[model samples]
Target: MAKYVLTGTYCPDVLEKRAPYREAHLGRLAGLKAAGKVITIGPTRDLTRVFGVYETDSEAEARELIESDPYWQHQIWTSYELFEWIQAF
Candidate 1:
């Protein structure tokens, strides 16, 4: 399995809209965690962005996961970045 880091930037003035979608967003992460695909996930302290580390078959698979997220679909996440990561620990 390869490791990936995914980053999401919150949409402008969309926290209110994001509330309704938060549960499903979390549920998706939980499902990924249960499947052993997610290493860790959470929003930044300022709530401006969310980040996750995941183990997946490939970078494309990781990209698929993020693109399919409800948060992305609903436009709660305005931008994203996915990168292969090397965990030194």
Candidate 2:
């Protein structure tokens, strides 16, 4: 499997709107982690950005996870980017 990094920038004032959907968003991540698909996931300390490193067979699978996120569906995220990562170390 290859690794991919998914990054997201939260929308302005999203903190207020995220409460209701936070659990579901986290639940999705938890499922991935449990399945060993997620390597690491978390928000930046300032909460402006979030990132997750995932291991999947293809880039499409990684993109699917990001698109399926509740944050993406509800527009809690204002911007997103995905990149294939080669962890040399």
lDDT of each: 0.89, 0.89
Clashes of each: 0, 0
Looking at model 1, residue 27 earns an lDDT score of: 93
TM-score, structure 1 vs. true: 0.91
Note the residue pairs that clash in candidate 1: none
Worst 10 residues of 1 by lDDT: 8-17
- TM-scores, all candidates, are 0.91, 0.92
Residues 24-66, model 1: lDDT tens digits: 9889899999999999987888878989898999998988888
With a 3 Å backbone cut-off (N, CA, C), the pairs that clash in candidate 2 are none
lDDT of 1 at 54: 88
Question: Largest TM-score belongs to which candidate?
Answer: 2
lDDT of 2 at 37: 89
Give one digit per residue, the lDDT tens place, for model 2 in 1-89: 99999898987777898999999999998999999889998888888998889999999998888888898899887788989999999
- Residue 17 CA displacement from its true place in model 2, Å: 1.1
